[model samples]
Target: MLTIGTKAPLFAAESTKGRIDLQTLIGKKKLVLIFYPGDETPICTKQLCAIRDRYSDLEAADAVVIGINPADLTSHQAFSGKFGYDFPLIADEDQAIRKAYKVGKILGFLFQQRIVYVIDKQGTIVYAKKGNPPVTELLQVVNQNP
Candidate 1:
């Protein structure tokens, strides 16, 4: 697992919006990178929907939320469309980003664990936790760091 206070590993990848370059995003706003197991699963759907529903709050705090999954672009497109999510859902098809972030498979299972990394404007990781953290808590982290 990545520890707090460390520099976030930068990457460029395809998202629902287009190619996202983490380096460029670093100095722009607080970043919330959500790594989930897969798309369309019950828990995954709920987790994403919660973020989608509270997206305005995230924006209010000057935070950008990006979800990463191993699923392909087609699956990501369908999932984001179904949920009406406005944020970018990145497709980590080769799992390189997942491994770099240290969100590896869970308990020998095929899917990665649900992990969230909150990075500040300087690219320092301020919060790193497992499972679905409350939207309020994430906003608090972003506001505090700023």
Candidate 2:
């Protein structure tokens, strides 16, 4: 996987909120690209909803949340709306973005290994960890810088 401080690979892909360009989405704020293996699974749903439930806090911290999966837009929309996900769940169907970020799963993986990357305003990664850890940790990272 790409390590912290690496230049975030740029990509413009389909998202539940519509076409989302990385650069365009990161406007004036840091971004958290949360990657899950697939959509609608138990852990994935819990993780996404956890973020959704605290989305206002994320926004207040001047940070943006975006989820990535291999699912297409149709699946993404259904998943997003079904759960009222506040952030964009991006469609990384071809796995281009996941490969760019080196976030793809191994053969035995359950779900993309559940990772999160906190990218600063300049699109530089400042924090990277596994399994979405905790929003508190993320909030601390965002509160401190990026």
Total clashes for model 2: 2
- TM-score of decoy 2: 0.93
Best model number under lDDT: 1
TM-score of each: 0.97, 0.93
Predicted candidate 2 versus true structure: per-residue lDDT over 7-79, tens digit per residue: 8888998788888788775558889999898888898898888898888999999998999988889999999
For candidate 1, write residues 40-140 as lDDT tens digits: 99999998899898999999999999999999999999999999999999999999999899997886778999999999999999999999988888988
Clashing pairs in 1: none
Q: For this target, which candidate reaches the highest TM-score against the unseen true structure?
A: 1
What's the lDDT of the predicted structure labeled candidate 1?
0.93
lDDT of 1 at 61: 92
Off by over 4 Å in 1: none
